[model samples]
Target: MRKTPARTRSTSRSRAAVVAVAIAAIGGTTLVGSPASAAPSGDTTQFKGVNWADPRDNYADDPVVLSGLSTSDTYAQTYAKASRVISAFRANLGANTVRLPINPYTVNGPYWKSYRGVIDAATAHGFKVIVSYWEGTGARKDGFIDDPATYWPMWNTVVKAYKGNSRVYFEPMNEPHGYTDTEWADLAVKWLGTYPSVPRNRVFVSGAGYNDHVTSVCADPRLKGTYLSLHHYGFWKEYATYDQWVSDLKERIGNCASRTVADEFGAPMTTGLDYNKATPDNNSINFIQADTDTFRQLKMGSVYWPGLRTDDTYSLQKLIGNAARPWLATTNQSGADRLAWSWGRGKPVSP
Candidate 1:
């Protein structure tokens, strides 16, 4: 979910704001795991990642062209450009994973053949790729799949293309606030049934309702082996103490921190907020500090929102150099410090 005047995305609460499955056997094939015997909670810390979104916040009626790549580029051209940008992410942020957005328009169109370069380049660099679906703009942005006819075929194409690649991970929907909890769970179960060959560990089932909470999805027995993706943003609240923010996050997670990955969480990076300091009166500062502290304490994985998005104040990295061969520079060192702190590196801040 993303909340900005430029783009209208999903919200966790009415106030505003931002922004996985299992396995089983069938038809004589022996499944690897069972729901009765819980799979060990994965090491979420392994995913040190950031989102690389389209300039339009990934809500487009047409193909979504990422910040540095164009729709007209060939596969080889995209791969070459993505290689430089991906390397810049690692050089500037020590990142090893990237979360990217996909929509029916992008996947079911001609640009898909070219877009494969982004995923291919990331995996070639040994980076984990999390491919997620985003809905269209205008009336189509109602927190639901725009059209099932296009939706299933999109997933079919995506799953068939990437299921065999160990470095690629799939997230069914970005934020399913349109459906009730039960409805969403049923949908997830259906996804799992459709793609049994993809390991549950590689699937990221979103939290119900704007991806604000994961307790319901974590409690679902059928989704045992999967990872859970969560999105939290400072704009969700007007103000909060560090401890209050910590408690708020913990309540949403319950005891499922091990299986949870805060794939999207951020404050305004270009605004000069000092996340390293203890600013009790500042909402963004307090939210960033508390969330990073909680994530570090729980050893949960986190991916900063918009590692590189054009003109987004919350984008941690900014594009530099030519459009064909782009690179990134950190927007705020203090904000970068908080991200590193959440990832279990960098100097610790005193509470």
Candidate 2:
């Protein structure tokens, strides 16, 4: 599903206060630390993951509170709740990685301490975490960094906290549809230069144009070592055959499968779509089948758009049991089967 336009809310803060918090949070680490050793080539397939998103689809002017998490909770409380949710993701979906959304409001505000719980719980459980920056809502949600002043400081705080952790990866931005391809590449170059301490392999450079394609970013020599993130949805096409979908996706990827991961691709899971059987007339079914088949054939890693979201029809898993200690139930077994197949497990379906 396509992202809904972000709703507006004010997030003004004292610049000096934000900086002070960042320095204290970093514990004296330099804003730009010395460059780390070169990163070895990575295997994208190791990232069998799902996105744990806010009920608002991770687009919020305020702090992004993920499903099953509450901002009112203390750090320890958030950690405990997150542990249960992360465990549910693994048990229900076989996920080993989780992609999370972060914004200045969450990282540079009072919520930072508590938000760390989500990251900590995921990593403690041996799940790789992809922390991506999401832009603000309403007028500020124009596919651009709302403010670089806050943006740089936000990254400083996050990089300081997780730079040492190998399982925690950083994605500079979600989907930069505002800039031209060349401009986006340049910005990514700047991000790499600013944080030489982050291993290249641990960074995910989003594909340009609402993250609809990766070939442009992949072709840039400056972005060579970082993994590229791609977002594809069935809504992008009104209707297409299985082979047509395959061709469309490949054209966006070009020769970059080795360094590409479809981190945001999903379809209607709760709609009772039978992805296991051929459904040429059903766009959602065709899209899911084609994308999963292509991913498996290419040996590429893919994270579903959302493993859990409150009200999205495309959510692969739904909350169940006690709210305090939440667990998940798969909304559609066939969708789960398709996800498993994409991850190199489960039986393949005929096209």
Q: Cα lDDT of all candidates, in order?
A: 0.84, 0.84
The estimated TM-scores of all candidates read: 0.91, 0.90
What stretches of model 1 exceed 4 Å from their correct place?
5-42
lDDT (10s digit) by residue, model 1, range 1-351: 765633334344332132111111112222333332335364688889999988877878998888888999999999999999999999999999999999988999999999999999999999999999988888677667777778889999999999999999999998877666756676777777778878888989999888889999899888888999988877777788888899999998989899999989987888788888887899989898889989988999999898988889999999999878888899999998989999999987755
Task: Give per-residue CA lDDT, model 2, range 179-245, as digits (tens).
Answer: 6676667777778888987888899999987888899988877776788999888777679999999
Error of 1 at 152 (Å): 0.8
Tell me the lDDT of model 2 at 125.
Answer: 98
Q: What is the lDDT, from 0 to 100, of the residue 130 in candidate 2?
A: 97
Residue 285 error for model 1, in Å?
0.7
